[model samples]
Target chain A: MQFGPHLLLAILEGLVTASILSLTAMGLSLVFGVMRVVNVAHGEAYMLGAVLAWWVTGLIAGHPAAGFVIAAIAAPLIMGALAVASDRLVLKRLNYDPDRTIVATIGLLYIAQQTTLMSFGPDARPVEPPFNQRIALPWLERTEEGWAWFYPWGLSITSYKLFVIAAAALILVAIWLIITRTRAGLLMRATQQDSETAQAFGIPVGTVYSVVFGIGAALAALGAVLVVPIQQAHYLMGGEPLLLSFIVVIIGGLGSLPGTVIAALLIGLSDGIISVFFSPTLAKIIATLLVAMVLVFRPRGLLGKAPA
Target chain B: MLEATGLRAAYGPVEVLHDVSLTARAGEITCLLGRNGAGKSSTLKAILGLLPPSRGTVTLDGAALHALPAHEIPKRGIGYVPQGRRLFRELTVAETIEVGLMTRGEGRETRDWVLDLFPRLRERLGQQAGTLSGGEQQMLATARALCLRPKVLLLDEPTEGLQPSMIDLIRDVTVRMRDEGYAILLVEQRMDAILDLADRAVFLETGRSVETVARADLTPQTLHRRLGV
Candidate 1:
């Protein structure tokens, strides 16, 4: 069987896609798990991150890579502040009622989307890829047999895709370590498990929620910056990923880190394979159906326990 | 070492505690006895600053506690084991204790001390707190509160659903803390245990202090009449 270069490229794209999805979904999961508020505006926050990255990159005199670094660092700080302000001004007053919170976040999301559309315009903006040169994997190359063979025999991959995979893996590990190994992590886990108990233990539950929201916002911003090279910056770019991230979170289980990563990868692979055999619209429909089925059978998600 | 004077609190317009006055001296166990909703939990919460008093004062060693937040209260040498043994259910017993110590910024020394006090906890340190039996959870809650090395420990309903043996273990621990010069304010339903362990007792009825008696002065008939038992 001959595995063409195009198919290999698709697989590589799937990995990168999964990486971006994981980053965005992790934040959504944390906020939902700990706060029990379905922040419909999370997507808008991601869009805001991309906008900040675009604006910051324009200001800094550096390569596209440096631009990404600047955007990644700055966007989260800005978005986090916004999230905290939103919580205090609006969501906090609602007393964390889930239905009310969802409605309020939806309103905020539309406001955010409109603000970006009005300011940045509808056209897609170009963003320079951080690196200019493409690196080839010499170990996996085309042979007399074809592109499909043992890694030592006949397969090839791009260095850019590998970088994306490596970055995502590093982030996943770092998040795991921070949650399990550090004091802040323990507090976060405690808050997630039971806010009332955590508060009684001399933990400032409000501060923990604010900081978690900040970190969650920052992660989404980081994902936007990372995705700039592949998808370019645009006002509407956040919508697709936002929907995909929700699917990822639901599939991964409402707050499990390991589940989020696995779900992201599955979504990425399925999308890639389906897009190869079918249209993007059909692939999306299939993805939605898959999520609905999974939810119907195991509402808690793949790794999630039933909510207490 | 802990005192509340003229403390008044309300949930909305309905007051739960009114002009509540009490004291827990160092080297003594002061137990509060009341029927359900008699403001036993509310008094503990008011002292810890969990519920801001509409009027009155809470002082720890003569330091004003009203202005400070709940988390800050623990730092000032007051440990609280709230109602329902509010242990972090998902965390292991060791982790639950460790979190209490985190606020103090002290290391393993505090944890080791708590474990020594509750040696059974040492055996179940790695077990999830929620998986522990009611008695074990109560022990874990007390151990977690003590991890802060507070001068005063506040316990609410500490022996609600424990076997008699576990209740005895908890009473022994309270007595030991009192001997070690730590002040304790305990709220409990087990009248016999309270009578045995407490140096003095305060009774509340409908959010008002109805009686304050020496532990030796309490009799079954007196308790029955006063508490409507």
Candidate 2:
């Protein structure tokens, strides 16, 4: 059997898509793991990041790369602060009640979305690239018989997609290091395992919760900034990624970081490949059905252990 | 080195400790003995700032602790091992001890000292605290508290589910700490063990102090009758 150039491109695109999806879902997973809150507003945070990136680019006169850098850094910091404020003012007061936190975050999602809509309007805005249009991969060339193929530049890939992939990989590695190597990571894991016990160890568990929430929000914001150049920024852009991120989180396992990354990649690649072969509507159905099956077969997720 | 004056606490409307007054002298083990629900744990919670006293004060070396948050309470030269041996389940014994040193602004040296105190912990350092047997977890909990190098230590129901050998180890550790000039306040339902370790004892009933007994006068039968065990 012969795979066409388009099919190969679709596969590469799927990998890129998975990277974006994983970045967003990783944030949601982190919050859920440590704080046990769904953070329904996460998607809205991502949307806000994209809009902010676009806005920053506009302000700087076509400096989209700078916008990306600024938004990537600022979005998380801002969202993290927002998360801390939310935890202190609202979520913390709920006393770690899962149900109440869920409801409150859902309300927060609406507020964040509507606020962005009000500020940015409903227009889909495009972010200009700061870097010059440099083609990293030459166009694919086919043999005269139209049965064999080769790449003129040895690789047929977009520089933008490559940049997104590299950025996402770097972010994931940074997150992994923070969660595993640092004292903050130890406190985070302890708090996630049992908040009371962590507190008993003289850790300010409340502070850990706030910081974790902030970090999670920041990751979501980073994802938004990364995706802006590929997909034009819009107010409603948060909804699609939110659903996909949730599905990825669920399929990966609620509180497991490694599981979340794997699940994100799986879902993103599958969704991309399916959409290429079929319609997006069908792809969504397939992805949802996969999630449901995973839930039924292994409620704890593919790599997650059952909650104690 | 630690004092509680006119301390009162409650869960919702039901008061658990009422105007409880006690003092723990440096280099001595002071035990609070009461039957279940007699506010023994509540006193420990109040001291640790887990449950804020509605009225009165807790002082360590003449500094007020009532206004401090739970996490900050440990920084005031006080360490707490709650009733349930509240070790982080997913963390290893070493990591569990490491968390105790978090607010101390100190480093691994403190953890090394603790590990030396409970040498059993050295062998099981990498094992998850939760996966340990109940007795090992208790050891880990106390060792973790010691990592803070606290001036005073609080233990709540430390011998709740321990075997005889483990209980003896805890008793020896308590006595050693007391002899080393560390102030200790212990809440224990195991009257025999508490009597064996404590220099003095206070009994509580219905959330109020009922009596104080000198350790010299404490016998198994007397404590059994007093505790109604």
What fraction of the real A-B contacts shows up in model 2?
0.57
DockQ of each: 0.62, 0.58
Taking the tens digit of each residue's C-alpha lDDT, what string does model 2 give over A96-201?
7899998999998888888888988989998765453555443445667775434543236667777888889998999899887889899899889877656656
- Clashes (N, CA, C under 3 Å) per candidate: 1, 1
User: Model 2: which docking level applies?
Assistant: medium
For each candidate, the alpha-carbon lDDT, in order, equals: 0.83, 0.83
Indicate the TM-score of model 1: 0.92
- Evaluated on chain B only, candidate 2 has a TM-score of 0.93
lDDT of 1 by residue, A1-308 (tens): 24555566567767888898899999898888888888888877778888888888888786677877777788888998888888878877887789999999999988888888899898777666676455543334566888643433334455656777888789888998999888889999899898766766778877887778777877887788777666767777777888998899999998888899999999987787678657678878987997899889989888988744
Candidate 1: where is the Cα deviation over 4 Å?
A: A1-8, A132-158, B12-14
